[model samples]
Target: MKLVQFWRNGRPALGLQTERGVVDAAAEATRLGVTVPEDMAAAIALPAGELERLLTPLLQDPQCFTGAPLAPVVTGTDRIFCIGLNYRQHAKECGLPIPPAPVLFNKFSNALAAHGDCVKLIPDYKKYDYEAELVSVIGKPARNVSEEDALDYVFGYTCGNDLSTRDLQFARGGQWVLSKTFDGFAPVGPCLVPAGELDPNHLDISSTVNGEVRQSSNTSDMIFPLAQIIADLSHHFTLMPGDLIFTGTPQGVMHGYPADQKSWLKPGDWVEVTIQGIGTLRTTFC
Candidate 1:
């Protein structure tokens, strides 16, 4: 199922993507005299049967559709873990060796930005780059999960952009969080797809800047596959529902370019990240 979170009456409301448009789940539930979870996080936290029960009505409805005014795929998530240099070509582009383990990093809740939102350029920095990634949304609590079972804990997937400032990221004492966690830095969504519905292993993912293709690659290029990332992460701490994991980006980032060829994101530049199955996530830097 493709689920979306969007604004209605100025508050976040749940949606289901369909042929006509987005099915406003909350609105349909109200009309059907049925009660369902109010938001994505709550729906994800529900038991499997209950979650299915709640979605059945919306999934079968012939109406209740509206144009998308989307919100972040998962709002108020507990943790937003990110992996660095997980693509062999990206690692080579950065001139770094393949790591012995998954290189984990993080972005805070403040960084969460929705599809179609504006990503404001940090005036203090000159080099802002975009990393198009596939995000895993945890469905249940998991601890020390095995690689075979890691995917079972996933609720779904969302397209993500790991926006970063190169100066603070590389030249300033290796402060990744400082460089990546600015307000509206982590832009994700359009909609989230159930884990069972899509193959994370081989999706085509790419990014464009001002209508020009900048990064193009497939998920098959990932150094540490999705399951391994989940397994490794669970070994260290509990993975909670609503937690997000940005699996990593492939080659062709601005940072990988030579000095003269580098073209960082600037104000008025429209950026879009597209992943197969999941739609495009568009952001305008302002």
Candidate 2:
């Protein structure tokens, strides 16, 4: 089943995507006198068995649903860990060598923006780029996890655009945090597919800007795949529920293009990233 969150009373509330429309799970639970998670964070933190039980009956009769405006998938996810240069071709495109281990970075909660939202670009800064990525949502606390069992801790998957400001990222002594953590820099969602429903390793992922394809590749191109990333990171620090992992982007970023062919994102440009099984995440720069 696909899950999402839509704004209710100016706050994020849990909802399920169905053929008809988005089912307000919290509202439906109230109508039926049943109890379930109240928000996206709680739903993702739920143990597998309990979450399944909670959804079983609701799937039978989805009433009082609406096509409400969406909120960021996890409004308050604890950590947003990001992988950098994890795709071999992407590394090559940037003229960097393959890394011996996973390269990690982070984005704070303030960067979270929802699908269909407008990302206001910082003025006088020109090199805004788009990165299409698959995000893994953590379901349970994990420490010292083995690669073989790493996926067991995953709750689901979502689409994300790791929007970057090239000048701040490269011109300021590698100011990755300052460059990428601008408010609304990370736009995610539209739908979050349960991990059991899709294979993360074999999916088609692509991104387009103003209807022109920029990045076109598959999850299969990731040099350090999801399981290895989790296992490696968990050994150093615990991975908690509501935490997110942004598996890196593929080649074709503007930074990778020849000098004459490169043009950064500008105001009024619409950016969209799509992953097979999961829905498209669309945002506009203003």
User: Over 4 Å off in model 2, which ranges?
Assistant: none
What tens digits encode model 2's per-residue C-alpha lDDT throughout 65-95? Answer: 9677899988776489999998989999999
Superposed by TM-score, candidate 2 places the C-alpha of residue 223 at a distance from the truth, in angstroms, of 0.6
Residue by residue across 134-229, what tens digits does model 1's lDDT show? 999999999999999999999999999999999888875788988999999999997899888898999999999999999899999999999999
All candidates' lDDT scores?
A: 0.91, 0.91
Residue pairs in clash, model 2: none
Which ranges of candidate 1 are over 4 A from the true structure? Answer: none
Q: What value of lDDT does candidate 2 attain over all alpha carbons?
A: 0.91
Global Cα lDDT for candidate 1:
0.91
